[model samples]
Target: MPSADRGVFSLIIINKAGGLIYQREFQAGLRKLSTNDYLVLAGTFHGVHAITRSITPRIPNSQPPPSPATSSPGTAPAVSGYSYPNPGVAVTGIDYLETDKFRLTCFQTLTGTKFLLFTDPMTGNVDTIVQKIYELYADFVMKNPFYQTEMPVRCEAFDRHLGAWLRGRT
Candidate 1:
């Protein structure tokens, strides 16, 4: 990707518990919604993400493990290279939701904070944009002394730097 696209629509940040920490629109187009509506949207989307992850198919183990009796007396027998993957905390939610008009790209951090970037559907280099946004989030938001975990992000430095960086990229 040579550069970040100029068609950025908006961004929304959600805490681990699915609370909206930040929300902003970069360009016009998306319909404006009431405050309660935005909160409901965040919560509903969080539920959908969880439901999708829960339905992931699991492959069954072909052969059962040997009986403990067949193994050494002190050690218990265990299956090799076979274990069920945890659905919860195992898979990241939907990476993106695309429509003809725009695309919603989601980037989730290790701490369970999620950054949702909305952009034009044809935009390329979106992953790069999201990554940079996340970096800015870490540096300006997470590292700030005043910032509180799982609380709304109200850092002026973060807002200023994020806008500047994204503006420069575009």
Candidate 2:
């Protein structure tokens, strides 16, 4: 991938409750916000997610989506469709990057773990990169016994691997 295709602007990890658990910016030129403000945003999003799940309609004994048909029955339920109860955070929506210099991509795991990835707006294959990051988090952070849920994700291995991977890709 080209350097421009792999550059990341920042990342944020939010808890199920929408509390900002972790955040870091790699590139420059984005407007800065106070640490307190970032925390508030996370908490607000968490509330929105809870509201969404509660409002999401329950599907009773319904057939899975077409994409799930290719997978085994054991995994078919995992591929079930989702309906957004609210407009924004409830559905993993992407908030616009400030100044148009970057793009913000949000990924919400089925367990309500959220990863916010910031990248160059024009970058390609960002979803792959984000998936790798999520994999790293599951391996290095979530698996660590020392990591407490809803706390800041401060695993040194995660940072090292993420930086090294991004550097290698760029």
Candidate 3:
């Protein structure tokens, strides 16, 4: 825990299914929550993120009009609004949460596992730090022979690399 990595209050990892697989506190500014609370929070946030993506508005396209429902039986059914070609509403993913006391930055991996980093509201370069964390996870955790995807991270290599990186940068 060197330099500003010390500013990092905590980190939590959640699987795509919204299970809390890892939770660790790096600093002491905030009170600790029970394990059940952490699990509930992860699940609730996942649901909210999914809901936001689902509710995204469809993009408008210049495609020809769709056939009516009453069209001939063999006619193709109308395309759903989601079929529009544009990147509708830009619901790529949830990124972060800002509060008066803390800033929670979320980094989601391509495989859908999420990393939540809680830091002091005044912390800087969190985006860079989170990206580095993801890189470490990719190199150390994901590549470890004993590591299981979507499970709690237990790789000593990951811990060492992450700690060294953070210490160096901070």
Clashing pairs in 2: 17-46, 18-42, 18-43, 18-46
| lDDT at residue 143 of model 3 (Cα atoms) | 84
lDDT, residue 103, candidate 1? 92
lDDT of 2 by residue, 67-135 (tens): 655667765356445534443544444433344666777678887778878787778787898899999
| TM-score of candidate 1 to 2 decimals | 0.82
Local lDDT at 165 for model 3: 71
lDDT of model 1 at residue 68?
69
Q: What alpha-carbon RMSD in Å does predicted model 2 have with respect to the real structure?
A: 9.1
* TM-score for each predicted model, relative to the true structure: 0.82, 0.67, 0.76
Model 2, residue 32: distance off in Å is 3.0
lDDT of each residue in 1-170, candidate 1, tens digit only: 33354468888898989998998887755689887877887888788777876776565567877776788876755766454466345666688999987899988888888888998888889999999889888899889998899999899988898888777766
Models ranked on lDDT: 1, 3, 2
Question: Which segments of model 2 are wrong by more than 4 Å?
Answer: 1-6, 47-99
Alpha-carbon runs more than 4 Å astray in model 1 = 1-6, 61-64, 67-77, 80-90
Worst 10 residues of 2 by lDDT: 89-98
